[model samples]
Target chain A: MAVASSDTAIRTSRITRAFIYLFLLLFALFYLLPFGIMLVNSLKPLSEITGGNMIALPREWTIEPWLSAWSTAQIGVQPTGLRPYFINSLMMAIPAVILSTVVGALNGYVLTKWRFRGDTIIFGMLLFSCFIPFQIVLIPMARILGILQIAGTTPGLIMVHFVYGIGFTTLYFRNYYAAFPTELVRAAQIDGAGFFQIFWRIMLPSSGPIIAVSFIWQFTNIWNDFLFGASFASGDAAPMTVALNNLVNSSTGVREYNVHFAGAIMAAAPTLLVYIVAGRYFVRGLMAGSVKG
Target chain B: MGFLDIDNVTKSYGAVEVLHRVDISVEEGEFLVLVGPSGCGKSTLLNMIAGLEGITSGEIKIKDRVMNGVHPSKRNIAMVFQSYALYPNMTVGQNITFGLEMHGTPKEERDKAMKEVAQLLQIEPLLTRKPGQLSGGQRQRVAMGRALVRNPDVFLFDEPLSNLDAKLRVDMRTEIKKLHQRLGTTIVYVTHDQIEAMTLSTRIAVMYDGYVQQLGTPKEIYDSPANLFVATFMGSPAMNVLPAKLVERNGALHAVLTGAEGQEIALRIENAPAAYQSYKDADVFLGIRPEAITDPEGADRNARNIQGFTNGVTVTEPAGADTFVTMTLSGKDCIARMRADADVHPGQPFEFAVNMDKAVLFDPKTEERIG
Candidate 1:
């Protein structure tokens, strides 16, 4: 770690740098073994996976399992694919991520810049949402969802995730903005920019890194949620994670292990894509707020 | 009413008042400087004038209009912050025109105003660049340009040059003074450096402990400070304040004190103020600047009462342009400023000249000026 931190140190010691890279490569291969196994089996035929080595390369490699998992797979006595549930997850996650981020940014701006009495206490109470056990709130959340009359719907899951996501998003934003200079806000006020104008023009423009952090965080949490999807949502309204479970556990004919691996990978694909695309900004955002916003 | 009136304004957070009954009225185009050490309420007073902070009581008026509850932007005033506060995401052109844009000015007019200010401040080439790309001096010019393009009724500066290096600070100080002269705009600048206050302001209000100790012209504040705080706070190496006896000698008033040689010396008062007669034989403090106590050759030749005395020099520091010699007077370390070429050294009994015309007396108990 120390050898990689400085250019001079790395240049002066080739043996140490080589050794560090070798160690890191070994660890990388070790960590990727499970993912490699899953991908390798997902491409093999069902007979090869049931009777042969799980880690062995297939003699007849085909994408039949991935296609079957997408369209014709049996999930809870239906031949309908996991595609609809994928759309459900996307719908729930995208709106939840966006709305929670906007709300969190506004909360952070008011908490740090436009401070009023007992603001810290209000923020403390809001933080309770982050720490409260997800299981503990299951009943109350279900009650609220029932009262809203949108139970078992995509919007219902969005509301659940959006409300639950605010605490973490707000936490990220407030700390980032706390390091921001208040003099800039005062200068804007003197320059005749109103509250919303300053938020949109001044605060939001400068909040790129934190917004990326919030979006990535909320999207991953909301998209991969199985407990909430299983407990509250049902049938066609179920998210990809719930539908993937039914595909694997349904006591139907053939018990296809290849299709189960494919369905599991499909359920995990969106989060992997999100992380791969936004991974660089996620690290930068966390580091920026951790060191100095 | 003057062009700007800060009449009986006092600011308090809750029960503790930070500014106490402050009253200063600035005339049209007068540069009023509020100077003090940090936390002495100089910045607070400037904020109140800019309407960034509310005035606790007593109304502030600009052009005879009450501005107690007016918004900062509605007050028609602009402020240059110590940090410059330029928007980092905007180009210099946009930063300069942001206020005009917010005020609903047309694009053509905003562009024209920004171009005029950029050219005036000699930053036309930097207009396309963001503030993050500009140097410290260029950033300062942009901040000032933002304030100037508004053509405000008043310009408030809260230690704007303090963020610069010493050389840049001096250069910017001169530029700000030149801009003030060319525009003749009423400006209330705040700084802890007394040199800036003296050089830049038409009138200065020296504050300490939430009180404006004195408000006068630079000459008045320096030559005749209202009290001990003003006298000591306004000069470099601060004014020498030592104990003395206001005794009558030879039918005239004299401030008698111990010289460096452990012998009594009497410096006569040439034209004593009328109240000095009443403090006969009473303990008082004598105030004198380092320049006032000089080598006999470097003494003010035109001073009516240049009383000469011999004192032992303990330390001689030959600073360029002038040499400072420290000696013991009235059992306190008194420094005297002498010529750079003055032949003086430690352990030498040097003959010093005291100009009585520049000397002021302060009452011992009250610390207020007696003469």
Candidate 2:
């Protein structure tokens, strides 16, 4: 009798587990549904997309929309493409990511190992920058860019992103470095290593995970940023996000929904690639950075 | 001039002082151990000596050179941290050779030094492995190897063995002592464990509350502690402090202690120093080691100050070789190390002998030793 009841209990637990998995599967599908529709519609011709079966696989599959989005799409008065804007975004993000991450790393090293008076207060203020609304800085930033005479250029956008991105990068690096043993720095000092030597040989080598995290975070933010891209860049200097916005919102011609979807995917592709390649490290870095030693 | 001199060092932050004006000097090739409980500023003093911390208001001289404002690398000292502090990203060989590389030593010379130190530490087989792959003892050896490769003017150890288990700590302590003996390099070690200080150091500085209470040889610190704090802090099962009245009896001084049943047991203060004369007829603390009070047969029979008495034992703890017998003296608990073979039981009277020549007395008011 005990065995029979235990068997029933096991069956009940299996049924509960199955139900839970089924619910989770449906929840996951709920999130993936929009992307699925975008993917399906992205493959179809304008005629089929207009027929409005958005979730169905394309009956007449074509790569013309992708080609058009890449090279021949009309954004603003220019008929060039998102290709230049994509390259522009890369140019802006790569240097910004590298500069901000390096600065943040140095700041983290000094804040943790070579601490001065009121260091925590300084860190707190730097962290506060991460929370300020971007709208509040837009006007002053525009004026600063105009004053610097680099307005509507890629370098101007790069500068804007670097200045704003430092707070988050510093936050990541500082919290990650806080758990690092200060004794290693002291040991290196006693070993005759100077400040930069210790940073280069001792710190940076051990900063792989946090570096990935910082780079990904900065790259994603700078790449997907429409506000700063639209505000600080124009014409040839416009980033992919701003170009995508122009393409989607343009009122000059008939709406090409497939082209819009393909352009959106292209704009989202780099960050998605980064996440897919290093998603595990991203999570690990976030966890390790937040936990104190 | 001494090899290393810490003259009137005072460390303060804002209005609070963590280390008072402290002074210590050690000759070359001397092994000095600074010992105290936690929050006693031993680590802070070590940091000052290493030039890792500012001296606030004092001069630290190494080999007749004032090290004030000097960087740690320029100070020519190597320290083995309590955490080992091995760079997790580097192999043991890289960790050992890093100092040389930073100093711009040639590749061949760096490899030679690394090999020599690694062999000395018996970590040669493990040199290629990272710190994460090594055991605790191996990691400790790697840390030492890192220091040893530098051949610095002085060596500083900050409780390097405190992280090890009991058996490993003992083994490493002996290894450190052997290494020091072989190298004869001047070393300044810091530990809270008095036993480690006693076993490994040529001189021990007993500190308490930012002050160096006593600085002497291990035997001197053990046999003649400076005050109540040093006396109580430097012994295993610590020195038992019994409240007693110093009474003058027939031109001699006697410490009058009451037994558990209110009976008086007068222990004669034989060879009492002249300083005790002023403390007569006043309450004092009679400090005695557990081994000083033992079973009659287990004591030094020919000692001039041996005194035997009967006391009621409240507890008996047999620890293999010697059984610890607890008794009451002047309304306080006192432990006596007795022979394991001695037939003694709790709740019964036992005969015990105290070697009074080794006993010490402290003034009740100042807690300072009274001769």
Candidate 3:
């Protein structure tokens, strides 16, 4: 009788497990379906893309659209490729990521360890900046970049991104350092390490996971930003996102769906590559930063 | 002048005072343990000594040098925190030599110091491992090694063994005592466990409510606690305090206790301290250790004023080596420590002996020891 009861229980558990797997499969398909369409369409010619069958795999795949998007694609009056803007995005993002992360780490160290009067209020103000929409800062940022004589240049875009990105990077590191034990800092101080020495030797070494998180987050935000890129840069200094937008909305040409899709995919590649490479650390940083010891 | 002096030190956070006018002096090579229950300001006092916390008032001198505003590193002290606080990223060897490295000690000298500390702590095999890979006891040893490698003027341990399990805590406590004996470095250790304070300290400072209740040798604190707080806080199974009337009977002082059954028992006081004479005919709390009230067979027969009385046993708790027998005295439950073999049954009359000479008298109103 016990064996019969156990058999029934096993059967019920098996059915429940099968249902769980089926639900997860559908959930995965819901997210992967759009990327599948983009991939299949980007491989096809414009005629097949404009055809009614959007979900079907392409009959004949070709790399011509990707080639055209990289080299001969028209963005504004220039017949130059997204190659130049891609380099422009890299120049802006690399320096922005490095500077913002360093500043954020220093801010985190000071706010958490060397806190003085009204430090929390200052942190709160900095944290409040992270939630402000870009639209709110668009006009002021443009004037500030113009006054600094860096407008219409990549440096101006880099500075704008750095200023806007500081809030998020600071928030990441502040929360991470808050969870970090204060005793380690105290011990380092008692070991005769000064402020910068402790930061360089002790705090920075332990910041591996958070560094990946902040870099990835800031890189993705600056790389994909279109509003800041469009308002602050022009012509030769335009970022890939701005160039991609111009490519899709060019008024003179017949609509080229495949080239636009290819351009979109190319613009997203760096962020996707970042996530693929350091994705594990991103999740670990989130978990470790949120949970206090 | 002592080796380390904390003169009238007080600590206040805003309007709230945590440690009030505390005074402590440590002679060189003395193992002083600051022990109290939680929130007793023992750790605060230790932190002040280490220069980790700022003193609100008074002066702290180390080696006759005023250290009021000295940095912790410049004060030449090393601390072992309760959490061990080992750098998770560094190996045990790096953790030990970090202080020396910061001071720009030569690599060979740093390596020598690290090797000596590792050998002294028996942590040589664990030197290459990160703190994350170590067990609690191993982490504790590495923390001690970090402090030992510095060879500072004083070693401060802030409840370093409190994180370990019971068996490991006892074992580490012995290891620490042996380490102190061999090194003979002036040490200030803080712990909430009185047993650790009693067994490891040359002198124990029993603190309560931000005040030093008593500071003396372990035997002195155990035998002659300053007040009800020290009397009760220092002992496990706590001293039993019973209200009694100090009556003058035929030119002799007697503590008259009325049991729950309305029966009165008078125990004579012998060689009472001079302070007890003024409390005649007044109510006082008779403080006696559980060991002083034992089974008649195991009682100290040679004690100066041994008195035996019959009372109804309320409960019997046999704790392996000794049985804790509870009975009623002055309408309050009083626990007596007896030999495990003593046949004690609840609700039955039992004969328990009391050593009156070892007993203490406290004024009921103030709870301060009178004799």
- Give the poorly placed runs of model 2, Cα more than 4 Å off: A1-13
> Which portions of model 3 show Cα errors greater than 4 Å?
A1-30, A45-60, A291-293
lDDT of 2 at B249: 93
Q: Model 1, B1-371: lDDT tens per residue?
A: 89999999999999999999999999999999999999999999899888888889988999999999888999999999999999988999999999999999999999999989988899999999999999999999999999998989999999999999999999999999999999999999999999999999999999998999999999999999989999999999899999999988788899999987679999999789898988999999999999999988899989999999998999999999999999999999999999999999999899999998999999989999996
TM-score values for chain B across all models: 0.99, 0.99, 0.98
**The best candidate in terms of TM-score:** 1
lDDT of each: 0.92, 0.92, 0.91
Q: Residues A1-293, candidate 3, lDDT per residue (tens digit)?
A: 34544354345677898998999999999999987887778889998977758898889999888998899988888888688999999999999999999999999989998888999999999999999999999999888988999989999998999999889888889999998888888888788888998899889999999999999999999999988998989989999999998999888778888888888899999999999999999999988887752
Highest-DockQ candidate: 2
Q: Listing candidates in order, what is each one's chain A TM-score?
A: 0.93, 0.93, 0.91
- For candidate 2, write residues B1-371 as lDDT tens digits: 79999989999978889999889999999999999999999999999999888888989999999999999999999999999999999998999999989999999999999889877888889978999999999999999999999999999999999999999999999999999999999999999999999999999999899999999999999998889999999988899999999999988899999998999999998889999998889899999999999888899777799888888999999999999999999999999988888889999998889999889999888898887
TM-score, candidate 3, chain B alone? 0.98
TM-scores of all candidate predictions against the true structure:
0.97, 0.97, 0.95
CA shift of A128, model 1, Å: 2.3
